[model samples]
Target: MFRTIFNTVVIAACFFILTALHAEAAGFKDVPKEHFAYDAVLWAQKYEIINGYSDGTFKPNEMITEQQFAKLLANYFELEIVEDELKKQTTTEIWSDEFYNSLASYGVPLNGYLHNSIRSQPVKRGVVAQAIAHLADAQQNLNSSIEFLLEHSISTGQNPKYENRDLQKFFGSTNNMTRAQVVTLLYRMDSMDFYYISDDAEAIHKNEDNNSLNERAIEAKKQLDASLQQNPSSSNLWNGNYRYVYQWGKGQYERNARYVTISSANSKDFYVRLSAYDGKYEGTTEGYAVITSAKKAIMQESIKGNRCIIEFEHLNNAIKVTEIDCSAERKNGTNFSGTLRKQ
Candidate 1:
């Protein structure tokens, strides 16, 4: 009798543990035990991809806004948020600017959906499908994002009536994705771990040979070095495109950038093109710079009767521009004196 009781108690304990695991999201009072999204919500909560309200309610049926979905994807992908103090107090910078810009850097098109005006509005399902297609690396030969989702068994559209079973689904692309549906979509995608976006921003992706991101970068660098060697007659390394993304105190976000392009002009001189545009103002000038030292050059240009002389100090894959009386080349708060990285 003692052995029998012990075996029964052990089985009962196992059953209890399984039950607890099954209802891992029971902490959310609004999520019923029979809810379809219980498992997905639990998974999302576990991974910190989604959170509940202050009242401890999951509200799984609530519609996710544009910013909310951006935050969700950021949490899932561990994307770094880049904030500019210059953009903080501007009239054009919205709360979701960093999140959207970060996602855009990863090649997600804005498509007029992530703008500040509609940031609080419900994000449509079409945008979600596009994100999934890009995230899963299913972007090849894709007629449409919806078709791609169906082909990959990632989705079967929002809902459907009785029809030909194979060709029977219509994903209301404009419909707002519910919280439960968003989590469920993420949970259903089984191909999230194949392609990894490396921390190196310039790493090339999408290779038929399956070369890793860093390996591709190595190959690309080798090719670029060869090209630069051919561009310059000698070992001069200043023949490439260099740019620095800058954010002005004004409302300009992406247009605020300084660019420098150097090309071999002759045996002793290099053609340099410099431009700085910050939406509110624009300045551009191109001239020839003669080699001064092993890693330095001087360029002179007269713009609107103002003699402009600038010195270029070349570094490893960068150039520092020092302006000397280049006031005519710069106008209305436009200045192109900064260090730029090789592109």
Candidate 2:
């Protein structure tokens, strides 16, 4: 009787170990129980795009850093790292040779803010938007394929819309995400059908004959207008300057400023001034840099010193900046200079 009991216990231990191993291999069993991003985490894991911590825990609720995300994307997409010296230099707070090259090779859009340092912060929705847009631009076929897959998934009942009544329960009573934007995202994912706006004479007369799409478009315009209102100078296509100061803590502060002006009329080029100030009196200097932008990507002699290039998407309002072999010099803990060209 004693021998039989011992054998049973040993068998149970082995079974539990096997189960744990399987869970780790699948990358799901270790994820936190309370993560809001559980679905996204599982999807990424299934695609072999991300991995859990070595300690058998997936910290799904934790914020991902910029460098970590860059590496993750680079590995998943099989981006190549260049071996040039300029590409390898790692002096600035944001500099990462491998990460930069990998991101560039993957056609990831680099904002003027991405210099040499990787930020340890939560990945924002806007970054996701930018990355997805870049991926869509890079592989046109991939976007359509993914879209079709999403459509099929939705059609097969994989995605279900929350009932209108449940919206308050799930999203809270005071949440401001418009019904239109929700429907639009869902429709694009094939999870929900578009809500039609009635065009009946009485309904039309009540609301000026606005259809659902028209109403949504108007809302979108309003939201865009509000954003522009916050940064009114950005509306000027030719010249603009904006500045903001933020306090972090005792003896720590920062001033973020940007200025754009016409650099050369002959080449139709524009120069942007980007600077960051630090400390109590804003007397301590952090860094200062200048970059140029133009319509074309080519390096025209008329705009030779500029190392940054700007391109507008077909939508016109969407802008992208690519930094080239720009250089910077620092002095007196407050003064700095750099040259960049806009493409």
Candidate 3:
């Protein structure tokens, strides 16, 4: 009886060990892996487009820096860098390192707005869209639908907001993506197709007038030109007229300001002033203002210069403005002020 019991116990131990090993082997089976990104990473890694961490884990969560990403693109696309040419064009520091300089020379817009901060931020989906679109445009391999989407995406600033359901709808219910979709959207902005449909059939029919990719490109260019006219200066003084007061506080007041007349003929120069007032203790107003743009409006207050600087761009078919800095000086207790007009 004792021998039989011992033999049974040994068998049970073997069974438990085997089960544990099996479970361990299958542990990651249910984990949704980014196979497409993984494949890209592998290619990137092999080509030194990316590298793993010191701990040997590739923390994809880490923001991809603009500089690093530019280099990656340059390497993949074999872009050339012209150091002397870039230096002559802009005072901005071109990533002149042998690898990064190539990207700069490839007309990548590494100057002014396309600065280096892109590297430190986790590579956003929208950025991925832009990059991919750029690549497709360069290669002339972009499909008409993809081209339309890319142009619209950049002009309107639309980026992928990956909802699993949305992904499934676009990529199919398999929840798996082909290398084509992954690479195109990941590297080329011209990979996805997008359309704007209003709640009414009339709007849809009207949009049909500009349905083709070429038409869309023309429209986008026109819009960009209009935008440039509106905001001629990379940094400019935005003016408006006071319309109605919205809110007020002890040292501050908010009002809707109208445009009296703008010095610049650009419509972007004209805005409905949502102004805030701070008492005469400081030369500047303690409140903020909102200026609407083709994509979105902005709310900002003065920090250091004569005015506050608000940064904006199109993303995901909308305008997003970020408050960059504020400039207000305290003078002998008088606020620097302006007005708005109706017509």
Candidate 3, residue 207: how far the Cα is off, in Å: 38
Candidate 3 wrong stretches, greater than 4 Å: 1-36, 81-85, 88-100, 110-128, 139-343
Return the top candidate by lDDT.
Answer: 1
State each model's C-alpha RMSD to the native.
20.1, 19.1, 18.9
For candidate 2, the 10 contiguous residues with the lowest summed lDDT are: 223-232
lDDT of 3 by residue, 1-343 (tens): 9999999999999999999886444312111245435544544555554554332434332233334555555555554443333222223564435543443333232222222222222232333333334443432212332334434453222224533334312322212122223333333332232221113322322345545322332322232211121222422233211221223443222222211111221334322112222332212232333436644434354423255554434343122334345444333312223322221
Q: What's the best-to-worst order under lDDT?
A: 1, 3, 2
Flag the better candidate by TM-score, 1 or 2: 1
lDDT for residue 343 in candidate 2, whole number 0-100: 14
For model 2, state the Cα shift of residue 117 in Å. Answer: 4.0
Looking at model 1, the pairs that clash are none
How far off is residue 114 in model 2, in Å?
A: 5.4
lDDT of 2 at 28: 48
Model 1, global lDDT: 0.59
